[model samples]
Target: MYRLYYAPGAASLVVHWLLIEMGQPHALQRVDMDARQQKSAEYLALNPNGTVPTLIADGRPLYEAAALVLYLADRHAEAGLAPAVGDPQRGEYCQWLLNLANTVQSPMRLWWYPQDLHGLPEDAVREAARRRVEAAWERLDAHLAARGPYLLGERVSAVDFYLVMLMRWTRKMPRPGDAWPHLGALAGRMKARPSFAALYEREGLSEWR
Candidate 1:
């Protein structure tokens, strides 16, 4: 069984949701962010970065929500959340996944935590980050429009779940992900999943719901 250290509504939500969706029996270890527990030396040992999520997989520790989710997708291939190695859409899957990790999620992080960037005024930093984040969503909105229904065409993929998680992060933004109609529809579909419902319940998230 996997042991997941998480903070509700944080990036860890993606990994937590994946475990539920995949029917994986996992233990939940709460990292109290309100008390700054993640920065403690003990927590650092598990995840040096002191992040909300540190997945203990078969005695090994893993971090990074996207990576953890991707790992779970690959581990539980029967879930069909990821395309097989030789599948043509596998390339597309990797591209979209990595792109979000780099471009989309990156800016959103800076937007949320401007202090991480330092020096610049917080407003200026968020203003710039906001445009980039919204543009990234605009690109995705078009992609989803063209693809229709899901990120990988007809069926769902882990990437769609990942996208939904990110979209929720943008809920308080000037133009949230759902502001883009296609993305809004996509979010609607994903939120309907029992796994997502469980995530909301566990995380005590109400706004994005």
Candidate 2:
């Protein structure tokens, strides 16, 4: 059995959703980040970064959302969240997976911790970072618009899980809905899934609305 350490509204939601979709039995351990439970020695032993969504599988700890999803998909290939290595779709699948992690999610970090990325005390610089995030959102929105439901059309691959988390994070920003209608719709579709609803209820994530 796998043990997943998670927190509501965090990237852990992606792994949580994947586990549900795969119908895989796993333990869900909620870490209270506000209470600093993630910083404790016990949790630190699991993940030095003090981050949520740490998965302990076969006594091995797996951190990072994209890596976790890939690990789960590979472990349960019958789940169809990932394509076989030789398949043509597999190339596109890997491309989008890396794109989401490296391109999409990385830029959004600046908006969250502008001071950490650039120095503090400059309203103009903050606004510039916000604009950059918005621009990235536009690109994602266009990609979704072209692809039609899901990042790869019909199949809800691991990339969809990545996009779902990204969309949720973007919703909290200023002018939230201005850039991505398709992406927003994708998030809504994922939320409507029974698995997502069940996880939301279990994790007390009703505040997501």
Candidate 3:
């Protein structure tokens, strides 16, 4: 069984939702942020970054939500959440996932924790990060307009799960994820899934539903 170290509705939610989507058996170990449990030696031993959504797979710990999703999707190919290796779509699949991580998700770090980036006024840094996020949404919205109902178009993939959760993080922003037409439609479809409702219950998330 896989084990996930997470905090409710955090980055861990993506992994949690994917596992349920794949019908994978997993155990959750919450790292209490209120208690600073993530910084404790034990938790740091498992994940040096002390971040949520670390998965322990086959007795080894894995960090990074994107990597974990990639691993799980590939390993459980029968779930059909990833394009198989050598499939023509595989390259595009990797590109979308990596773009989600490197382009948008990195900026999310600064958006959520402006204190991490030094030297500038925190508010300015946050505003800059917010712009980056909105730009990402605009690009993604266009992509969805052309190629989506899901990220892979017609068939849902793990990348779609990742996208929905990332968009959820932006729910409180000035122009939220759903403000874009395609993204709004995509979010609506994703939310209609049984797994999404279960995630809301599992994470105790009452807002943005």
Over 1-209, each residue of candidate 3 has an lDDT whose tens digit, in order, gives 99999898788989999988888899988889999998999989988998887899999999889998899999999999999999988998999999999877898879889999778799998899999999999999998899887788888888988988888888888888889999999999988999888878877888888
Which 10 consecutive residues of model 1 have the lowest summed lDDT? 199-208
Of candidates 2 and 1, the better by TM-score:
1
Tens digit per residue, CA lDDT, model 2, 125-154: 557666876776787788878876777888
Give the TM-score comparing model 3 with the true structure, all chains together.
Answer: 0.97
Query: What's the CA RMSD of model 3 in angstroms?
Result: 1.0
The TM-scores, one per candidate, come to 0.98, 0.89, 0.97
Higher-ranked by lDDT: 2 or 3: 3
User: Who is ahead in TM-score, 2 or 3?
Assistant: 3
Q: Model 3 segments beyond 4 Å from truth?
A: none
Q: lDDT of model 3 at residue 137?
A: 94
User: What pairs collide in candidate 2?
Assistant: none
Where in model 1 is the C-alpha error above 4 Å? none
Q: Highest lDDT: which candidate?
A: 1
